[model samples]
Target chain A: MKIFIDPPNSLILFDLVERFGHEPLSVMATIQERVDNLEIDMPPMNVTLTDVKNGLKYAGIEVPSGIRGRLAVWGPLIDQAEAAIIMEDAPYSFGCVGCHRTNLLVDFLVRKRKLPTIEIDYPRTEEDARNMVIRVKEFLEGLK
Target chain B: MVRETRLVVISPLSEITPDQITRKVHSLGYEVTVKETCYGAVLEGPPETVSKVMQELRALDPLGIYSKIRGFPLGDPKRCRAQHGSRPGFSQLQTEWQSLSLVEKGLECALRGDKAEDIDIPERIPVKDLQRFCEEVE
Candidate 1:
């Protein structure tokens, strides 16, 4: 199963999902593909015009390009996901904190999909960490 | 040729000391800059050198040591926890650091070829029950 994690770039979530025998749809893998593409000159700065247009599928033309641009990257991943794990109340640095609007839009889309999902809080203590891993493990195992 | 930075975390359950990691890295004589942290050490240098250092570091304790690429370069004041009181992700990193012991245990179990049957996970609440609870709260 492809599991979509809220903070899409979280290594902890990525590692846990993969360790539990599921693929984690993460930002690192997405961005790495774009960066590796030779056709795009100067990489991240040079978002192909076509890529910007692709955002229209998720957002209207009137929406800010930043949100659209983000959607262009994340929208497809969300569509591919069979399940999702959301970590709530994470600090800004926990994952891609580039655009708040994109985060909200992505979250709304994930829930709207109505897939098997589990929302967990960011662990602040050792006990919480233990519980977080256990819940993640159980959730992934259930999917099998 | 892109330079890179990486965070290497040592599991709390491991007997390896941070000093041991620091000394071992320095002994390798790479051009990498190393910052010793509470969890482990941060390395910054050419991607190849960083990768080499990580390979050697992990060899010290394969299951006990873990490494991940960092988004920022070393000592970037905007993201440095020391310069700015607790940079955006430091708390998350700290919290994750606390959980390394559990991860290490899981890795050990995998190495021993054991299943996760030992863990006692409770029965999950059905979606209908959760919806009812939400409706009651509303």
Candidate 2:
């Protein structure tokens, strides 16, 4: 099952691959990137991506219809997502925890739109982040 | 004295984990304060709770605390209204306007037989303009 993992700090990603026994495919920059590359990997394998606005600025990358701006501004984008792992903060430049404005959108998508969602807590330290990755991997393994 | 138990949970108000704030407070043996405002409350609790709360607060990095301050001043039972000559305190104005907007939207939805969810209320409303509007309506 493909999962949209929000951007965790770089250290967290390291632990996810090293300790969790999961292959880190690619760090997601934009929603369109995921959509374009979805076919490359078949279903049943998880593909994780961070919510970066980089792809949306490419020369020919057409803005996904009905979505634009910061993820908070693009509430429609998450409507079709199967499941999501929302991290607390990958970039402190934005709000520390997941964006509050977008949270209501996540809630709408989860409760009203019926998307499965798991809100990840912000890691207090590098070690804690690593543990989170381990825990998340263990939880996902249980599902399989 | 009416002891107002407040839980001023100051996370980034984003994707906070369950009990993360409470755990930190409890680690220092302080009960959680329950209020959302950051600077608007004067806390009221047992001396231990108050002391530990301050100590825990001092331990937190000022920049990273993302604190929500919520508490009431423990004192005599008296309504602390602003002086007659002072500037008007529109403490509840925001909620009032929000309620009014929701009502207007509801009425519109009822008349048109549309679902309330379909209507989008602008999250950022101009409070000064709203206060004026409220006065005009009244």
- Which candidate leads in lDDT? 1
Error of 1 at A41 (Å): 1.1
TM-score of 2: 0.28
**DockQ of predictions, in order shown:** 0.14, 0.01
Candidate 1: segments with Cα more than 4 A from true spot: B1-8, B12-138
Specify the highest-DockQ model's number. Answer: 1
lDDT of 1 at B102: 66
Residue A90's C-alpha lDDT in candidate 1?
A: 62
TM-score of chain B of each: 0.80, 0.30
What's chain A's TM-score in each predicted model?
Answer: 0.92, 0.44
**Roughly what TM-score does model 1 have, to 2 decimal places?**
0.61
Per-model CA lDDT versus the true structure: 0.74, 0.36
The reply for model 2, stretches above 4 Å from the true place, is A7-68, A71-77, A89-91, A94-100, A107-116, B1-138
Q: Which window of 10 residues has the lowest lDDT sum in candidate 1 chain A?
A: A89-98
